[model samples]
Structures are given as structure tokens and as C-alpha cells.
Target: MLVAGCSHFAGRRPLLGYSDKGVQHADTAIVACAEQLQYVCGITGVNQISTWEKFNGGKTPWVRVLPGRQVIRMTLSNSRQLNRQDVIIDNVQAGHVYRIDVGSSGTLLTATYTDLGKLDSYTIHMPRFPLEPKAITASF
Candidate 1:
């Protein structure tokens, strides 16, 4: 199992009780990020993920993965910002591949599997903007 706590900044400086407000904001962000991560993992058929928050003069969010889990959690700090994060699993076994796409702001994720039920190379097509799509070939 894996568990991690989110970032927290406190006790640095207190200006008219603003530190408390800051802590609240940070806690909200951490919870939101954890929820997003769980949603993405769930889309990938991973159902043994959970997250919670701990407050002790600061805020920290933790994620827990159950036993025999093969999932990764992805957390985004700010949903208002537009960014791209991609991961390619190379040398994957010849079988059905899973893809999970999660985030706000209309982000898209694509995964392709080829050469199933045959002894041949598998080709994956992934779009990169309006230009030509990116091709990834894997042999087994």
C-alpha cells in the first residue's frame, strides 16, 4: 500500500490571522486534487484507492493504495491552468491496454492497441494537435 500527504505551509508568518485562511485554502486544494486522482484511477479499472486529509496547524492530504495494486495517482495543483501530462507504457504485454483520462478544462487522452490475436507488431495512434498523429509501435 502507498500513502502520501499533500503539501502544507504554516507557521511561517501570521498576518492578521491570514495563516488560518491560507491553511483552509490549501486543504481544499489538496482534497480536490486527491479526488481528481481517484477519479482517473477509477477510470483505469483501479478501485482500491482512497484519500483523506489531516490538519495539525497545517493541512496535508494522503492517498492510500490497497494491496496488489498496480495503479498510479496523479494530482494537479491548479485546475485553472492548462497543461499536458503523458505517459507511454513500453514493452507492455500483448493484450488489452487500458487508458485513463481525468482532469478539468476538456483535456483529452487517447490509447490504441493493435495486432491482437496475431503475432505481429502493435501500432498505437495518438493525436498531437492538428498536425499528423504520433505513431508508437511495440513488438512482442
Candidate 2:
């Protein structure tokens, strides 16, 4: 396969002498980079969070892009309210995955992920979508 042969022809020549392997790698990488951009281009701000405090009588959390409902949930004893939102701006360009969790109270939030290659489709359910609430409010 040309992909397998890429490194074998690495650094073969200058502009006057370019390897077909170099061209193939460049094209492949470009397309891959574009596809990756599409994934996040649709995700931003609170829309980045899968849960917010506006629903379920402010109890249950919301999940997106995942099947199977969460019938029950619990918070650990050590868990605490965030008090402020954790803003995360991530680029998965180098095969990295980012998890952004916005707690139901809208105060507690987290962002994390498994190894990029190891992450799965459903597990990576975080979609390129709009923010929750769509608006922020503060009582005067």
C-alpha cells in the first residue's frame, strides 16, 4: 500500500525531485485534517456541554448523541459544585479526544477523555452541536 511505502521514500529529493509517496501523504493528511475540523466546527460554548440545569426539575442530567437512557444517577461523596464553568478549547488534530461535562446544576463541569485511538463512537457521543440553554441569565 502507498501508505506503507511513505516512510520508505522519505526525504528522497528536493523540489526538482519529489517522491510520489510525498504527494500521497500530503493529500491524505489534508483530507483527514479537513474531516477532523468538521467534527468540532459544529461544537462550541455551552452547546459543547451535554447537560445543563434547565430541565428535569433541575435533577437529571442530559446526554447527547448517545443511545440508552440514564435511568438512575448518583453523585459521589467527594463531588462538589464547580461555582464557575470550566471552559475548554480543544483541537483533536493530533488524534486527541476531549470530554466536556456540564453538571445538571450548571456549576459543576468536567472535561476529559480516553486515549484518542481507544475512544469509541458512542463513547465519543459528544457531538458537534449547539450549546444548551442557548442563553444565559442572571437575576438582578
Candidate 3:
């Protein structure tokens, strides 16, 4: 497991998408999720981030991604339960900024994202705290 705060160089905010080689800032877009309701967990084309980074109170408000079509997966939680969601953003432009918004009605959790201009968005919803096989195994 990758622990949060593993290195002094790895600051509280983590950079997602792209590597240490040949990255052009002009061609990259940033996606942010400011609400504590959402915790970004995976990017479709990238490796899964450490769970500690996702759930251990580590702040992941924003992430960098190559401008294009991409899927962002995250978890939404309330006091009683947690749910997972995915937002697919298409036609993301270079140097643009986006944000994910999380909301809930009772046990139904919803996540959505829109560009800075509020022109486009994608959303997903799921029931809070659906049974997970891993949870059962872990409890044993």
C-alpha cells in the first residue's frame, strides 16, 4: 500500500496524468473537485491511485490530465454510507479547467462535472453503501 505523506517531495497535492517526460502545460487541462463529498479514485487511462491517497483525508481537489476524452472515477460518502461514481468528460480542451460536483438525495449519490464555462457535463449516481464482497471478506 502507498501511504499518504510518503515523501517530502511528494506534497499534499498530487499531480495526475502524464509522466516526468515531455509534458506540455499548454496542452494539458486541469480537473478539480473541491467538495469533501467526492474523492477521486481512478482515471481510466492511468493506474489506480493508492487508497490511502483516496480515502485517508488526503485532499485531491484537482488533477492534471491530457486534454481529450477521459473518465474519472470517484467515491461519494455521507455520514452513514459510501458510494462510487464515474464522470466521463469529452472534448476537454487544452489549458481548460473543470470541476466535479457531488450531491445526494437521501441514499442516492450523484456526481457531475462541467467545464469552467458550464457548457458540458457528465454525471452518475448510485445507491449509498451497496454491499461489497470485499467488505464481507474483510470482516471475516
Candidate 4:
């Protein structure tokens, strides 16, 4: 029984996940420039990972993006923000690091962009989803 109990430890570490192939963004990709993703600015893949490390306890199929060499996890859940049907994740400030709380079961994903040393900041808000959202702009 002891051996069976230890089975949980025999697998890949946490804070790691994989999305479908053909993700259409590298670092520095803006929403208007690339395929419109509802929740991520940059994602990690071959020749595209800005940085990816071990992050734990998030909903399945979340995308990890690197806006400024920092990791931000995008999650979607039923957890509402401010007791309303609005923001589930919030970035109160910019030019800093923020750890997204996955345990909250929230239902939105937000990313904040700021021109440092300036008074300009922009944030993107999107609904929570289990699959990587894609925007089709062209066809072959």
C-alpha cells in the first residue's frame, strides 16, 4: 500500500502545461499584431519561450505569458470580482510583478502593460477559458 500511495509523486512537476500546436505568438506580440488571444501576451514554445518555470496550482489549459521576462498565468473560473460579472483577475499596478491566484476560482484573465517611468499603462481583460483562444485573420 505504501508504494501505491507514492504514485502521485511519479510524474512531471507542477507549474507546467502544454497547449495545442501552432500557437501564434512569441514575445513582444500584441493583440492587434498577432492572432487575437483573449488572455495572453506571450507564450512559451520552441524558439518562443521568453521564460517558463515551475508554477503550481492553476486551472487546466492556462497559458503562461512573458511580457517583460516575468511569468503571468492566465486562468478562468467562476470566481467573480467585486461581487459583479466583471473582472475576475485584476492588476492594480504596473511595472511590477504580480502572482495570479489560481485558488480563487475566478473567471477572468487580465494583463497590464505600462511604459515604465511614464504615466501610461494598458491592461487587457478577457473571459476565463480552458482552451487557448485564437483569432483567424487569414486562410490558405
Enumerate residue pairs that collide in model 4.
15-55
lDDT of 2: 0.23
Write model 3 residue lDDT over 1-140, tens digit each, in one string. Answer: 24423322222333565564477555667666643434433222322432224443443345667767777666666666577677788887866667777777767777787677422322222112332211100000
Off by over 4 Å in 1: 1-68, 75-79, 82-94, 103-122, 126-131
Q: TM-score for all predictions?
A: 0.24, 0.23, 0.59, 0.19
Error of 1 at 90 (Å): 20
Question: Against the true structure, candidate 3 has what lDDT?
Answer: 0.51
Higher-ranked by TM-score: 1 or 3: 3
Residue 139's lDDT within candidate 2 is 12
Q: Candidates sorted by TM-score, descending order?
A: 3, 1, 2, 4
Off by over 4 Å in 4: 1-7, 10-47, 50-68, 71-73, 79-98, 102-140
- Where does model 2 exceed 4 Å of error? 1-44, 47-53, 56-80, 93-96, 100-115, 118-120, 124-140
Tens-place lDDT digits, model 2, residues 9-118: 32122111112333332121100001121122111112223232222222212122211111112221114442333332332222222233332434443332322232
The lowest-lDDT stretch of 10 consecutive residues in candidate 4 is 82-91
Residues 1-140, model 1: lDDT tens digits:
11211112211111111123333321211001122332322111112332212221112122111222233333333424423332232332322222334445455432222212323333434333344544544332
lDDT of 1: 0.26
Q: What order do you get sorting by lDDT, best first?
A: 3, 4, 1, 2
Candidate 4 local lDDT, 54-140, one digit each (tens): 231222222322233333333333323321111122322222222232223344344333322212222322222333322222111
Candidate 2 positional error at 3, Å: 54
Candidate 4 positional error at 3, Å:
16
Candidate RMSDs in order:
18.2, 21.2, 12.2, 15.5
What's the lDDT for all of these models?
0.26, 0.23, 0.51, 0.27
